[model samples]
Target: MDFSDLGKLKDLMGNAKLMQEQMEHRLSETVVEATSGGGIVTVRMNGRKEVLRLRISPTAMGSTGSDLELLEDLITAAVNEAGRRADEAMKSSMQGMMGGLDLPGLT
Candidate 1:
């Protein structure tokens, strides 16, 4: 509409962009660790939902070949748990950063 309104809009967009950058940095820095199957399988994931590391205990390989299926299930469980944690952590972080600022098309 008016030039002053346009300037305010520009500022809002700039601030939003800055917040987006900061959130991305925070997400990259955030990490969560989880384990499953009595800690036989462990996974570390970031807020971006990327698995940074995975560990499997030697005990997962039982004497019987049937143990392989159990190991797979354990790994899946561990990864899913880590992903759930990352989602929660990121959501909390975003809420704090956003400070209830529900901008149009941003929420």
Candidate 2:
């Protein structure tokens, strides 16, 4: 609209970009690990939705002649647990960034 309004909009956009960049940086620095199947499998993920590491316990692999389906299930369960932890980590980071404002659907 007016010059002042245009300036305000530009400032708002810049602030939003800065905030997003800070959030992304913080998220990248956050890491979370989750395990399942009695800690037989572990997964590490960063807040940026990146998988950093995966670990399988010896006991989990010691199942010789075991059902293939069972192993698959265990792996799936472990990965799902890791994903859950990742989501929680993301929420926590966002909450802190937003000053405890849990904005619905922002994620």
Candidate 3:
């Protein structure tokens, strides 16, 4: 390739690296929350997909054995939803960084 083309490629690579670093920082800072079972279970997560906190309503905890299984299900649903939200947040941030540039083979 021509020198100009090589220089442009290098610059693109550098920008990509910077974007990646910025994304990492943003993911660490961004937070998302999800709830399940009429908000009996709540989960908080960051864009990095790390769970920050989980909260269960006392009413969700019943003395019945079946209640334990329901509680487990609610917790699982809340956590999964939180993770999904985190993924979406990260994807949106990445798209913003890309700034509408249509890269081949990349969403």
Candidate 4:
């Protein structure tokens, strides 16, 4: 390859690295919230799919006479929804960074 082509390749690699770093920073800063059971259970997650916070309404935790299984279900639903939101956020961020370029294995 010519020296000019080599220089261009290097520049391309540097740009790619910069974009990756930017995406990582953006993912860390991005946050999403999800709720289940009519907001009885809520979850907040980052674009990395890490749960940052979880909240359960006092009413969601039923009295001693209430059903424990229902509470568990609500929590599970909230967490799953949070994860889905995180995934969507990441996907959207990636698309923006890539400028809609269809990269294999990226989606």
Candidate 5:
């Protein structure tokens, strides 16, 4: 193999190791919080996309006229918000690890 090919292989291996470490760190350290129904419902999620906690306000439960609709809307909103937060966190963490380097087929 040429020296240049050997060098490229070394770099690729280094990048793979870096990416693995970064992914693990991100999974363990990142958490995102989201709220819906004007903060009546709240959710917390980890970087691994696991739901950590959920909060529901008493006012949200006590709404009598359209309780089911309210509940559905609140759940949808909270879920969407959580997803948004997760996407943002993932992008930020990946960007930091990547150091502005572009890797096709990786993202």
Candidate 6:
């Protein structure tokens, strides 16, 4: 309401914007890899939970129905693991950045 409070709010908004930009940069830079079925399926994902790369070993591929089902499951598991790791990485990177901001509804 007061001029001083308004000025402080402006500064807080600026800081929040800067932090969001930094987090976006970090997200693009952060890469997480995960494997399933003893590395038969490998997944590389970014902090945004986007899959960057996927690799399935030759031995893991087959023509049979059961083999295909197993492969699908393995891929699913690997992608999920990669996404989980990405979330962890983002949290770890942003840990100390939000310490004192205390932005209402954001913290």
Candidate that scores best on TM-score: 1
- For each candidate, the alpha-carbon lDDT, in order, equals 0.91, 0.78, 0.91, 0.88, 0.84, 0.92
TM-scores for every predicted model: 0.91, 0.82, 0.88, 0.87, 0.80, 0.90
How many backbone overlaps does candidate 5 show?
Answer: 0
Query: For model 6, where is the 10-residue window of minimal lDDT?
Result: 98-107
Q: Where does model 3 exceed 4 Å of error?
A: 104-106
lDDT of 4 by residue, 15-104 (tens): 999999998898899999999889988999888888899998888766664457887888899889888888888888888889889999
**How well is each residue in 1-107 modelled by candidate 6, as lDDT tens digits?**
99999999999899889989999999998999999999999999999999999999999978899999999999999999999999889877777677765556543
Rate residue 72 of model 4 by lDDT: 83
Cα displacement (angstroms), candidate 6, residue 11, comes to 0.4
For model 4 the local lDDT of residue 26 reads: 89
Off by over 4 Å in 4: 64-66
What does candidate 5's lDDT look like per residue over 1-107, in tens digits? 99999999999999899879879888767999999878999999888878888888877775476897888789778978997898788887788878887878444
Q: Write the per-residue lDDT of candidate 2 for residues 9-94, one digit (tens) a residue.
A: 99989988998999888788888888777887787888776778888777666546674566677777777777788788787777
> What ranking of all candidate models by TM-score puts the best one first?
1, 6, 3, 4, 2, 5
lDDT-better candidate, 1 vs 4: 1
lDDT of 3 by residue, 23-98 (tens): 8899999999999999999999999889999999989978899999999999999999999999888877777888
